[model samples]
Target: MSAPLASLPPRRLSWQFLRLVTPYWKSANKWQVRGYTLALLLFTLAQVALAIWMNYWSRELFDALEDKSLNDLLMQVGTFVLIFILTMAVTALHMQVKRWLQLDWRRWLTAKVLDQWMTRGHHYQLQLVGGEHDNPDGRIAEDIRIVTESSIGLVHSLVYSLLIFGSFVDILLTVTGSATFPGTAFMVPGYMVILAFAYAGAGTVFGLLLGRPLITATNKLQTAEADFRFGLGRSRSNSESIALMHGEDIERQNAKTFFARLSQRWNRQTLGYLGIVSFSSGYGALLPVFPILLMAPQYIAGGMTLGVLMQAAQAFQKLTSALSWPIDNLGELAHCRASIQRVLSLYNDMQVLDEQASEPQEHRISVAQSTQHELVLRDLCIANPDGLILLEGFNQVVRRGEHVLIAGDPTVTISLFKVVAGLWPWGHGEVWLPEGPAISFLPQRPFLPHASLQSVLSYPQPAEHFTQAAMHHALECAGIAWLAPRLTELDSWDRVLPLRAQQRLGFARLFLQQPAWVFIEEATDAFDPKGEEGMMDMLYRELPNATLLTISFHTGLERHYQRKLLLNRPAQDKYLTCSTSECSLTTAPVTPVVTAAD
Candidate 1:
């Protein structure tokens, strides 16, 4: 299993978190974000001012009660009503401004991630190599959300705490006065502030020790949740096959296994939370009384008014809460760290893929566009991902308006087609194609995007590029005229259409596209002999000048082609000779005369 994200050291994790967040403040939307942020800060300051006022008001109201002054009490109550209204207005505006900033930041970040993932086929390469990024969809859809929301929340909370602490600290110092050590002459000013710091500092240390394992637990939970969701999606996508095979029990067991793993991680997370709550609950309960206890002596001795005592207690609580911010939000911090790590890992992997893709590899097959009107391969060598040679030092050339057939081992034939299409480039030698020529590739299993039938047929091109009459004509030629009337209907055509119909649709698209060159990789396998013959005839008649290159095992269609290219796995000595020097190139076996068409 891959290591959990929580395994990263604190310093590295913090750097990654900063990397993820810094881009937004530097993005194109920075000005708008700054405007919203500035508004939020202004509102925050207003709210803090109101809170300080209320803290003093509490003292005054209590003193009014103590002196039995009804007039003063009524006036204080009226002032309280006015402050409450302003507080409510500032708070509502503050929340909306903060939310706007979060939305803008999330949008920019999501777009940036998508651009990186989709560029240069990085998504495909990630799947091909099975990289560390497990679920890119989850990273974009879920992890980005967590990072944005948590980051904004953390900023808001920290700002609020700092402002409150700043507003109250001086008040606390003034109320508590100076203190002299019991047996020494050493004196400390603002001793209440000092005590609050020491107390909150201890709580922060304890919270960190107890919550150290929570990060790993949270990462595990995310992984387990993704696995469970993947299983459910797989089951749904293949429900028909499962029901037909009566494999419901097996699928149920698979689902149960995924859920069990998720439950185990969830239980571990809950246990971590239990430890946190046990300490925090008792710590929080003692806070209010602790402040009053220290100041109660002065109030009882008549050295301070009831109002002064109340004000001092409230100030102490606010100061301590600010100092204890990290302790209170330990769980959220862990969660945010995990999410930031996941997103940064994905972004970093995509960057690696993009760089690797852009760099030229010595082992890769060289492809170039030529001025000549022909397809040429010189000393072509195709290898599997494991470096096993499939085709050694192969060479072929097909000029314009020529029909050719390629027949060989199924794997070798398909790999050669992929190399020519520039999809699988990990090979040797060079491929030269006519510059600016339109080329189409038809694979064994056609891909039909989930879109309107018209859009699916025109794929990679807009539906408006072709007229209704042209679409109908192509469908009739490919022997699927029934679909011509349903051009505007939208559905999952790949799943909805039978395999034969899907292949026919591919041919229909080929007909509509009418490219100058067509490369077929056993795309007609689904058709019967008569149907194949009819489709081949239609293709020949429709685009008589278009070059055709086909890879097929069947000999029936050989008559349609003017030439054939056959691949043979020669003896070790012959293979080595071909590899070292291009002198052994031949389309025929040494001792026998054979054709791919035969």
Candidate 2:
């Protein structure tokens, strides 16, 4: 029976996002975040000091030049040299500190998100509604990289802007005070504030107006590109099938059409980017002149010295940096936000299903009673993802050494194995397998990780764990001895091997591992009847004492088993089950336990 988790889940983005991000701080390198933060704090404080001293140095050096005292000139020169040295050292240290911090943060974030992707079985369950709903592979591998890099860069730029603003604001106010219109104190605080806000708002609004569309466009384009790539992959992997069907021209035409869409979207995005750059670059070059124009009157009236004039110019440049923080980060910030929304949406959708398990499955599976049977699913009930009732009160028992065959419905058997393997969580009723029994499941599509042949042969166990003799023996038993010579030659053996060969390898591992119980799905679905019989013979010979449970609708293998069970989708509420004609294949219905917390 499948695990039941039927409930709507909470998906407030802010809270869920925080829950997602919290795991990074709990990683093994947590102390590194602390150490880097301390260094950044010290470096930031030092940077502020240096910036302030430079402002004072500007005025003092000009004063010394006006006085023309050799002693004062020498003193100013030496002080300037020392200030330069200190500034260089501080900047270098800050750079190194930030580099490590950025990398540390990225590593922590990627690892945490990746582990979550693999842990919840969301990666597999996500496959059902399969037109690129969520690619955990892309999310973990690429999206995390973008988010981490963009986030760190944004933080650094914001911090630097804050320090620059703090260092120059006082100097700016003093320089502006020296200027006057006749007699009344010149007041331009309001003008400066208004300008800052206007500049930031314009860039933000413009960037969003032009850039937001690109994010969504790029995401769509990426999916299309992946589809096109996957089509090519299919061509490569199923060359024999494609060739037999004479689909070369058909596939070529389809691929050309897919690439055409990809090209169309990319071209539009390029134009959008060009439009943004045209507007932004115009603003950048014109910005430096505005500060000088605002302060021109002070220098002309002799209200400020050359040093004070330079300081005022620097201040205006500094002000632009402060006002333009968002503008500078607009691209990265947009991409980061887009990625956040995407990842957040996926996490929410995946989690939303099992939030509270409020809706119980039609067939309630539970432990009616322990019968000292090898396996017992009491009053088991399950439904397809589309609400099609698959199995109801699907009672079954496997004796200690009996080989049981579950036949009749192809869809039913496949769904049942998924539920029993503890991979599918959409069904109800408790499936009781003795806790101590070792259960090994082989699905129709088995996982083939990228590694050496030896590593592939000894999957779930590292390559080093298996002896050379054992490696050859296992491959030979699986009739995959063609790989024996390449045991040390590492590659993607799973993809390289034929589906039949891979299943043979899976069976070989099953036999070699000698699990207490073996649950076989349509692992041999792609193979001929003879091949299926051959593999079953090998399985029995290898694990004569092991309890064998098989799911097959072929009926050809029916002769191999003593106990046979069948299932059908009778209705939305009732799933059909029949063991033999006279029995009517029915069992007592189970009452599922549900609590408020459940």
Candidate 3:
């Protein structure tokens, strides 16, 4: 689980944020990114310089009005026009540069995240080890956008505020001068500067108190939003199954439940925003008036000119606004914080998986590569994530070109299947995979990505990699040759094709790749007995030299394999025996291998 954003100290969060973004700055495109960043900062500085010019221009225009000089007023008006044009141009350029940086940063970060999530089957392992990283699709798509765009925006505003404070503080001090105590001889220098800091500091304290609830509320709202999106996506992906099962009522109820949770979170977030919005409105309304009222005494007493008075007020507003950056941006800061924490949580969980693989524990099944041309499982014990034993003290050695059928309990066989593929590790054992090409595991319902038929057939490889003739031949062999005419057409093949056709397409892929080793988990179960026999015959005939391991509930499959391994529970009477290297039953083996050739 991820720690709540509110509980994380500012320094710790800053460190995490730095770790997240530092790579991009030092990446191959560093010079280009840095060049654009520098341009943005320069444009911002130019904006401040124009603002300073406008301040002095305002004072001159007011002084001209007091004197009733048409010529001086005209000159000041022309200066105002010039300043306005320059400000608009600078502002536009700054926005373009900032947007460029945001898009580039987002693209790089999204690619990095996608690579981490997809590489080495981390996506599958993440599911096995559950964490707060639910709906990674949303995190990758939405949260990362928010993180990049909002982070750059926040940084720009923060830097702008600091510059404004530096530029305006001096102007405010000079215009307002010092103030003496009402009854004492003590005089405070830069009285308006001191007052601005005090005002901003007090407002920040109150705003923090009012807006603290927003952090937790925003986190909950984002989570609810992701959950709702995930629910809808799952339903859409499984629309065919749901419609066939007549599960519309259940699905509709699930959607309503998801929305209800979202609504609850939305209302809580609204309540959290109420205090901050109300306080901000009042604070902003008083900003232009507060400084004038304080300095009006001197203006009325003829000690300060109208121009100086107006200048002092504007300067005071700018300085106070700069000092209040945190209070002003509390809501957006909360939003950006939530996204950052969510992204970091997912990244940390994936890192933990990497650590687990690097440092193997005694309780885990260690899978390693070997030079031998055979798959070896020694003293194997498979367990579910909950530590419940499924298969214990199992040993097997499958040489190259052997046809082996793994039968019996589906749970045990499936767990062993994943263990061999290095996707499951919740047990004690050693699995040595021969050094060769990758082992292809064809599931019962193969994944058919929404793409051209040719691309779908040659998934994880480019469609251009295979010749058209080869693709057509493979399709004909798998009985999906009718799909060859539409190979160039793109569509959701999973939805368009039936179960049998899709299963056949899976076989067509195996034919095209012609792997040395194949593991099939009910890939042909959807077929009738005759169809199943046909697929088995085609598989053996097409790949005579390839090794094969299959898991199926159907009978008569033994005739196709040289050996059959049966998974069964150990006898209760035979006590369990354990050791550091192996845990086995005192009696015979729990898994009995039958020689089909006998």
Candidate 4:
């Protein structure tokens, strides 16, 4: 992230970030990208041509001004108008084409990042692990915005400067004629090139000494601003709690203080910009006078025409533009480097996580579709973030329609269910599930997306994706028939509805869908003892042939299941086999004490 440094370690800047970008170009749509790049190349050439034309116009206009010829002035004016019109037209068209590329590139980038994030369920796993830094949404929205827009601007500036340099070099050399240097046959006008170089070098050095520190400051300031924005968003999301607790005053105080710092940085940035503007303006004003001073005597003495003298002045200004590249584009260059560095850091983090997950210590997890008719786990071992092995050297055969109760500590057993459901894959294991799987997973806190009741029931898809009858039946069966009228009404269900009602809707979804495998992670705990029993009875009534895998800490849940499995942490006691009839792992009347001594 030390992007302010003039020279970054090549290994840190583009190397890793380029790795992330490599996937998109390698995609099936790479031809589209190739075409886009080809178009960009052509666009660049056209812009360069325009720049050269601008240099020609600058010289021609100045020469006309000096001679005061009415006919010549009219001719120059007409030519200038035509070229200026062309310039604006080309600029507008280029923007349109560049926008097309931006959208395509953004679409491609979003899909690729989302695919990887949701690919192996990395998005969910990221929440549980160090992938908090993944921030895929941020990468998709903000980071991509900066990377795209800034890149286009950077490319345009570069091409413009280079073209100006190439075109103006001829004028500069022609003006010098050849450096006599006290007794020489003329040195091929190298003296003019040297003069331009020295001026550019001096400007860059002085500017850097006074202003380079601003680039470093800008980088830090941006990071701080992002952090502050995240904080505000966090508070906004918890507005309800904040209001109830009457913490708005505190929030306002904090935000005011935060924005105050932001304003301070903004002012510093303004000062830096002003200093740059002052320097460039001074350089620009002196330019016209400078060429005249050098070549005016030569022109009056008949060494060259009024046209040639004016041409040399235009050439000198254009040459200076080329040399002043760093000074001219300092802001954009800093922003680009900072953005590139961030993406590089993110890419490196993902790679590091990939390596750690596959290492022997973490037991690299693998997933495959069940070839046969059953869900099977061979040599399955689930673990904690700290490498605490929960399920070790395990083998299990899940028949098509067996209700299995996993009766261990709530957390570890639920993790096992996730591992089996193919949601969590951080631990070392093999989960073999049936092909074209239909599964209904109910976590302790079910996710209810903001949508209509029907869409909420559908959860991950639209209401139109499923039949109205099916959704109605689900609501009725789950004892939520009242919600039937609200199926077409769309609102934020997460905020409007209570947790228990959401769980009822969840159960209704399971009952309606009737998936072959139903994974419940302490979902039924929402209801009281009577309600739990009634719901279980309804579940059995609906899906008599379906398999139910429940994870619960409550031992009372054991009686409802035909099979039970226990799990414990890695750093704790060893795992021992136990039977349903009698078990020594349970000594507490209500709590289960698991140990190796069964």
Candidate 5:
């Protein structure tokens, strides 16, 4: 039974939407959300009460006009002024309350999504392992806004419509009462209500059928829009590179391609809207005359007054409007559905990542804290996600205070660094680390976060953690003292600073932190040999007891390390072979080289 229910299309979609939105209602802001919800409910009830009063007023005004009673018409006109003022107040308050709730919900949702996306480097993993979530930034920024506003608007409209239907259905039944055909025994009770239902129900069925393609079209439009925006952002970020390469034409063509796809989806949505409008317009235009046509004989026979005929028409309109919600807002419904699906897809992906991290796996690298003051890798096997072995059966230990250089195929060396840093764990291995040593890893191109120069220098740490004097000293030792005075200034320091300056800053951070263990991945490659030597000399001078593991192609740094490790891969094999060489202070120069078969 549950399986069958799950197989139902509407139920599946509703379940997905509820799952995506339930977190907000149950979140820490539940009390505030409930307060806003209560206000909206009261507003909706007020509107319904106003509608009922106005319906009766309409009948009274019309009957006064029909009888040519000037005094009654003047009194009804005064009543109209009061009703209009109250309606305006109610409408304004409703809109303000709705907007307030939308903003609060959007704020909470944005924070929640950002936290989930950024936690545990899940955002990086998503980019590395591409899947259905193409552009998370758009989902968090644009889709969340659409979902919150549209869902609230739609729910309010739906609830109000239902209230109107309930209040006016009895009025319609009372006015139309029962109809009997002449010379026939058949009688249809509350025929006005039944006619309104049948008319609106048919229109709804046709509306849904005509609007079915809109959901897919809207989804495609959103994706294409995100892709196009991303393309524009990428072009802006890489403007300097493009300008240097004179690739303006290529970039323009890429923009045109993305725009073309977006336009195609827009055209499809337009066509879908055409069908919906054509049907809904005709259906709605005929509603006012429907009740009149059904009761014309009673008015002609003097059984119904002009006011009663008008009242019956008004009640029928209300009942049909309530039942025609799907027909009126089908396009919005499609858009809401698409937005909900996109957000839920992102949420589900994050959940999947969390689940994968928690579950035990046979191939996961075993990591533990060790009593020994060294970093150890025992029988380590590193492989890509596709199971292509990069390094296998490798066992090694780097004791405390050892300066070692690993020279290998750039890919393998980088992978090894990531493995040791515990970023890449899709392999069989056991890694043991000294229990209480702070470690830092610097990659080939250091990351300078978008922050104050001080924050960027002391990153993964707050700006206040280091004194201005310490930062100045580290900068001077790293041979980039020119940056010391600008530490307080904030900007996109990553883009503002030159490559050599950024690399110098990485070392500056290392000097300030003075971690017990440091892993360097070609961090000094951007610097000239003399500059590289100066930075290396500063490292040895400042943190003499720190264990240094450097991965670099330049053999010029060979004299700085007391030991060397090399990785080799033969053409016939899939795994790497590791070899180590120990050197003494007086040993002759030995260049460590890594060769991999094509």
Candidate 6:
């Protein structure tokens, strides 16, 4: 399930990259995006044209100085002003166009990945089918920015280099002309052109050799950084529990461990950078002087004028610089590749999940909807993520308006609740649900988002969806009517409210939703016996005809439900070993539901 996407073979990596990027080009705004891209390209072309004009302008100014003519110098000065104005305008416009395209592409890519990550239970499923996608938040937020911005910058530079190489190669050839060795009759044509290629070729080969280590180091460093961020984020999220357990010292150690790992990777990447930088320094220092020295012999011999010699040196430098693009950008290329790999890995794993879900498996759970107003579980079996059977050979049918109490091992009951809601799929069975209204599940701990109290009550629905009176009534029924006045105040309700108050808010949502079917999992555990009884009474008072299923260990809950079912574990302490294909039913007894009449 995991592979080094950064080390993928060039052809496969290109295909993967194209697969990711092609969607935006063909999206609904393709024409507008294309127009912007076209404008950027035109600006690039304009930049190259300006560079070529400046090359000739330099020749004229240098020649005028050599000729000692005031009129020619003045004429060249006017041309210089024209070139300066045009260069400034083109450079500024090119920057704007490039930024527009980069941001637009980044926005599209971010939205696309977010949709895949959040929709249709993919977020939950991704955790179950784990792979290299550890910190999805880091990948979406930081890595996407690097991929979009660096990619555009790299591509523009590459195109500019190619254009310069093409235009300047011919100029170097013409200016250098044919050369003969001092003592020989044999002459070499366009010798400077040949020398420029050899210089750039040698630099490119050595640059890549030295840069190989950098690519590996960069990928590892990025992963370490992401892990460190994830550790911090997790600690922040569970700060309340950590504080209550007095686990701050353990958390400090964990943070130190994350940072130690990051520091080790940083040192390795620094070593990688050293080699490339040393070689680049020597190569850059020689570029300007190397061309002039070769042209020096011809200039001293009076075979070429100062104007032609200077122009020839300039042409040689431009041609070689164009060919040196790979050498100049080696580090940035490594960084960009690392980001692309992280993004592609997340995308590929999600795609694999989709593929697995589409193909049918013999022991896989199948969830279906029926027109009948009842829930049916046929030959149900529940297993944990490790393929160990927790509960098996279960069958149940709950009709509308039945109040059922489920008492069992906590793990088994929670898994059953998720199975019915279609959130846990690691079991074999058929779950036929009523088609009209969705089932509502309230877990042990309620999640209160940071928002207005009114919005908190109407979460997953608009605040305006419920009338003010209904909101107030729900609050009263849940025993938190004191919050009614603060419905408009925005705050972090989860942080400020106590566990009991948060539980009340959860029940208030159930009142607002008014679902036909409801499942509760120890949501009343925070309350005392009297408070729990009052909450139960309030539920029946508000929605007497609604079908209710409660999973709890509280003593008096049995009195509220007409039927009681007890889940019994086997005497054996070991888990039932089984594979998906040949899963055998566990003999763990499940006591049949007994009616209150019995």
Every model's TM-score: 0.88, 0.82, 0.94, 0.84, 0.89, 0.93
The TM-score of candidate 1 is 0.88
lDDT of 3 by residue, 212-247 (tens): 999889989999999999999999988999999999
lDDT per residue (tens digit) for residues 310-398 in model 2 = 66666666766676786666666656655655565555545543341333333223332344647877667666554446666566666
- Tens digits of lDDT, candidate 5, 1-598: 0122212376687887677667887788798899888999999999999999999998899899999999999999999999999999999999999999999989988898889998866786676554567789999999999999999999999999999999999999998788887999999999888889999999999999998888778878988999999999899877877888999999999999999999999999988888888998898789888889889998899887888889989999999999998889889987887877778778777776676455453345666689889999887766664445666667788888999898867766787887777666655668888667656998877888878889998998997989999999989998889988788888987677777888888999998888999999999999889988988998999999999999988989988998788864323334222223321112222222433221
For all candidates, the clash counts are 0, 6, 0, 1, 0, 0
- Candidate 5 weakest ten by summed lDDT: 582-591
lDDT for model 2, please.
0.67
Q: What is candidate 1's lDDT per residue for 192-213, written digit by digit as tens?
A: 8888888888888998888777
* Residue range 1-598, candidate 4, lDDT tens digits: 1233225764656665566666766678788877776677676678767766776776677778778878888988998898888878877777777777777766776666666666556666656665324345565567667776777677767876887788678767866575454465655465666777777888787766666656766765665576678669878867767878999999998888878888887777777777777877787677668767866666777877776666676677778878788887887776777666555545445555555455552245566676676778776766565544556666777777887877766667877777866666655657787665666678887888777778788767556778988888888888889989999998877667766887888898787667778888889777887878788888989999888888776666666787777765544543322233322221211222333211
Top TM-score prediction, candidate number: 3
Candidates' lDDT values, in order?
Answer: 0.82, 0.67, 0.87, 0.70, 0.82, 0.85
Worst 10 residues of 2 by lDDT: 1-10
lDDT preference between candidates 5 and 6, better one: 6
In model 6, what is the error at residue 70, expressed in angstroms? Answer: 2.4
RMSD of 3: 3.0
**What number of backbone clashes does candidate 6 have, counting pairs of residues 3 or more apart or in separate chains?**
0
Every candidate's CA RMSD:
4.7, 7.2, 3.0, 6.2, 6.8, 2.8
Candidate 1's C-alpha lDDT?
Answer: 0.82
lDDT of 4 at 467: 90
Off by over 4 Å in 3: 1-6, 182-186, 361-363, 569-598
Better of 1 and 6 by TM-score: 6
